[model samples]
Target: MSNLQAKIKTDSWINATWSEYIQITENSDYQKAKFYYNKGKFRIEMSPLGNDHASDHNIITYAINLYAVVKGINLNGKDNCTYRKTGYQDAQPDLSYYIEDTVDAVPYGTSIISLDEFSPPTLVVEIANSSLADDKGEKKNLYEDLQVKEYWIIDVNKLEIIAFAIENEGSHRIRESQVLPKLEIALLEEAIRKTRQTNHSKVGLWLLEQFQK
Candidate 1:
């Protein structure tokens, strides 16, 4: 590609090949952009993550970890992890988890997890302050086709969580987690609401009390 013909920052990804998608994601301009490539198209998520988004991301992460510990469940979680299926599909979930019986799903020190080699995460989460639409539609299809057990989108603006259960290459809305039994979605949402009024330390303490009950 020549100087004038160079791929612009806002270039369309619809007709771009998988190699082109990878090249664009590697560009310095999109260092913070989350990437999702499925079928023949790619979507660059350049939404500026706001303070609320980051707060919910952190709280949910901590809450899940605390819940697992309190319940004696085996699980591992990742933030901003990339899972790629080579030329076919790729997803960079904001947070992902390998639940009990699959805590060691991916080996240590591996970068850019290749879905062709390893199993998909048991749970995937997208903190959706601004990207809720794509997170619910296109990204949902990506995770479903990737065969993740559960997918969640935390709507920061609405203080709501939209969970889904994936099976047979399809998904359906869910109210509670199928992988982490006894974990109430409502309680997590409640904790998210409390974060607006208090710090994570206090929110976390309250969560601990709730989980133990």
Candidate 2:
């Protein structure tokens, strides 16, 4: 209906192979749902979906807000930042955080930052339901390759959180506890549960207390 939406709609009509799509639109944002070449001939590539009901976006936002508030940590909530140069791929992590000290590393007031410009977040969280494979597979590889310090996969269906920490270059090892020792994993879990029950300010307060403690 709007110009931006119209442009996205138009781009969706162009039929291009994954390699061709990435090669042609390497520098620009071509928003559409299509498949791309990875290890095989093709892999389904698109923006993270936000369906009308039970969208991952809402769940991710809620979790991030809770985490930030409970931990009293400064974070930037960026969505749909294109992290790759070659591929019809763009990832909108449910929520991403750049900690207090590293805030100035990235330019301010920008929603989209190039993957090469700044170091990866202390933590990157992906709320998974249907796109679990992509989050755990291709995107997991992407973030690991980018050298993100930590990554979290939150499964809404199962209400479980799995975290991965990078050990060596391009290697991710699963973590069983909060890397930030001051913050309790149980508190985070409780906040997540509260978010699912009701979007409340208490989650934020709980996070702040953890930071202060």
Question: In each prediction, how many residue pairs overlap at the backbone (N, C-alpha, C within less than 3 A)?
Answer: 0, 6
| Window of ten residues with lowest summed lDDT in model 2 | 4-13
Model 2 regions more than 4 Å off:
1-19, 23-72, 85-90, 109-112, 170-181, 195-213
Q: How do all models score by TM-score?
A: 0.94, 0.63
Q: What is the C-alpha lDDT profile of model 1 across 42-69, one tens digit per residue?
A: 8777867879998999999999999999
Scored by CA lDDT, what does every candidate get?
0.88, 0.55
Q: Could you give candidate 2's per-residue lDDT for residues 40-118 as a string of tens digits? A: 2233345444542144356546556555666676766565354433433334455666766675557766555555556
Q: Model 1 — which ten-residue stretch has the worst lDDT? A: 4-13
